[model samples]
Target chain A: MKRALTKRIVIDGVLTAMALAIWVVEAQIPLPLPVPGIKLGLANVVTLFAMFALGPLDAGVILLVRIGLGSVFGGGLTAFLFSLAGGALCYLLCLLLRLVVKDKQIWVLGALGAIAHNAAQIGVAIALTRTTGLVVYLPVLVAAGVITGTLTGLAAQASYLALKRTTLLSRLKGGASLPKEPDDVAGEEDETEKKNQK
Target chain B: MKTWVWVVIVAVILAVSLTVGVVLLTRQPQGNVAYVYVDGELVYQVDLSKVDQPYLYTVNTPYGTNVLEIAKDSIRIADADCPHKECVEQGRLKGSPLVCLPHRLVVKIAEDDADSVSR
Candidate 1:
């Protein structure tokens, strides 16, 4: 049981590392919306996956690690604070949204999360800049958030479906040393699957 | 087929979008940037319609002289010491922000007396 759990942790670590790498690489690209706090929200995919796979606590760990690591790799200390503020806000919102929302509707959660994140960062920027004049760009940032979050939600959903299909998925879902399901493997998982049953 | 493909596609889309953004940003009308000066202290109260004639505000930054003009809106330095002159080229900032990276100065349209969306 412990060995299986170890292997699962290793896999989660690897996936988290991959997500961090993507965050780093994406940062190199210039932002399209010059309105201040807008972004493509590329790395939110990993957070979505982790949220679903490992639950909110584990997801938080993944999120903080990814942000800390990604920020160091991409932006410096001050820069990290900006993105971190945004990412943390997004993470919290996504977690809350996950409970009330499900299935494809998760896209809406992602969209809202992105918008919230952007809003928080803009607030920070306004305070730091000592200039409250950039408020005009909020509309554009919200619009961008809805778009990018939808895309990321779709991407994460696809990956989650694929991962859930794997045997390793059920094992991880069982949690470390949690009770293992017996005789379910030969019978195409439980009837809990809403999409696959169709 | 691969996750990296999604990343690459997003990156490409972002690159194209940013390129388009630069072009569009350049085309935006250069309005006036009002750095409100009250009682010899630099303030944030520059009005375009209120001002009768074209007025120029000279600002010294790391990028040398940043000349902002107030007509109907706002416009900035025609010539700059900075290589990227993006802020200068940003023109007027009545309804937006003129971000000059070279000088770490951002001139944005204040929404206090404005009739636009709220912050």
Candidate 2:
């Protein structure tokens, strides 16, 4: 039992590091769009992957650590608040989404999570600045979120599939320690069988 | 649900948001008067049309400093001390209001009548 706990902690740490690295690197790339709060959100790919490979609890831990450290390294207090709001919303959405979404459809979680994240950030921005004029950016942000979210979602789905082919995925699942709820685990075996057949 | 159902739903959302975004982005501002607010309080109002000479307007808030470039018939963030500098990258004010989220500073072009009514 102790060994499983250690393994889970180690895996979470590694995923957190990967997420932070992606966040820092992505910040350096200047997006052509002049709008604030718009980016590829590539780091979310790691979170999405973790959510499926491990579980929501592990994914939440990785996301929180990444956002906390990412803010310290790049953005400061304001960024921290915005990220907290956005990340929390995104995490909750994915938690609920995990039930219905098939492993192959991880991109759906990614896309919807990105939209929820962006919308939450906009809500924070509006509340902070106390400016209703900022609403003008909503449609643009939603459109951008969908496109970027889909791309990141596809990336996460591909990564999950590639990893599933190896023994690593099973090991990580074991390391997660907590048994998944029966409902959550339902259809998973069938999905794997379908994939194996293909 | 089938994967195709998810795909179609996302596609429709993408289509609608893109259409609405384009329309909003391309729409012209209603007036030439620019209102600058710091921390939700109105601080400065400049009529872009009346500016014969371009000048820099600096806003020093508790969050940070943002410098606005007010030119003939247009305004933009010339400089800002914020981390991302997204407001500066926003370029000249068009339909969307320029926002410096970190600094809680907003520069928006509003109709003269609306400005008077609010005051």
Candidate 3:
């Protein structure tokens, strides 16, 4: 049991590191639209994956660490506020999404989470700038959010599916015996995911 | 019901937003008063139609400074100390706020009555 606990900590730490790297790299890319607060949100793929594969707590940790470190590395206090508000909004919605959809439909989680993130960001921008004219950008921002969210969601789904094939996940259950076949793992997921929803 | 179905619904919503955004972007802006804001406080307001000659106004903040070029019927960021210079590249503001996230600066156009409501 102790070994399993250690392994989970190690995995969460690694996921946090991975998320930070992705966030910093994505910030370097020049956006085509020249729009503020719009990006592919590639780092969210890791957060979404961790949310589904590990649990909400692990996902929240990874997200907080990434945003806290990301802003220090790439932005200032104002940018940090925006990221915090957006990330918190996204995570809250993702948690509620667990009840509405099955594991196979992570795309829904991604799209909805992205939309929520953008909405919160817009609210922050408007508040910080004291200009209601920023609302003019909402439609395009929402459009971008949906497209990027769906893309990242699909990527997270692929990673989740691929990870399930390995015995690494089974180690979480007190390092139990590995499932011998792919079918065995798939069948096991059907049961655990249902329990996870509640 | 299926994953693809969810994707379709999101796509449709995206399409509607895109259409609306494009329309808004292309529409002509009617406001003559341009307001510049920093960290949620109104700093400057100019009537574009009243400017007889083009001028540069520099706004200094703890984050950075942005030089705004004001002219008849239009205003833009002539220069900025922010890293990306996105505000400068934004060219001119017609309707949407020219936002500089790095410097926490925003310049936008609004009607006369809009000013009282926001303040």
DockQ values of all predictions:
0.10, 0.70, 0.56
Tens digits of per-residue lDDT for model 3, A1-198 = 665566567667777877788788877776756467666677888899888788898899889988998887976776688789889999999999877777678977888889888888888888877766778888887888888888888777777766677664655434445445745654555444323322
Q: For candidate 2, lDDT tens digit of each residue in A115-161? A: 88888888889999999777777777888888888888887788788
- Lowest lDDT 10-residue stretch of candidate 1 chain A: A189-198
Residue ranges of candidate 2 with Cα displaced over 4 Å:
A175-198, B114-119
Best-to-worst ranking by DockQ:
2, 3, 1
Ranked by TM-score, top first: 2, 3, 1
Scored by TM-score, the top model is 2
Off by over 4 Å in 3: A172-198, B112-119
The lDDT, on a scale of 0 to 1, for candidate 2 is 0.83
For residue B43, give model 1's deviation from the true position in Å.
7.7
Docking class of 1: incorrect
Per-residue lDDT over B1-119 for candidate 2, one digit per residue giving the tens place of the 0 to 100 score: 99999999999998998899888887898988999998789999998899999999999989899999999999999999998898998899898888899999998888767434643
TM-score of each: 0.65, 0.89, 0.85
Residue pairs in steric clash, candidate 2? none
- How much is the lDDT of residue A142 in candidate 2? 83
Which candidate, 1 or 2, would have the higher TM-score against the true structure?
2
- For residues B21-82, what per-residue lDDT tens digits would candidate 1 score against the true structure? 45544444344435632222354557665777776666675335566666665445455555
**Alpha-carbon DockQ of candidate 3:** 0.56
* Tens-place lDDT digits, model 3, residues B44-119: 9999989999999999877889999999998999999876676787788865678987677888777666434643
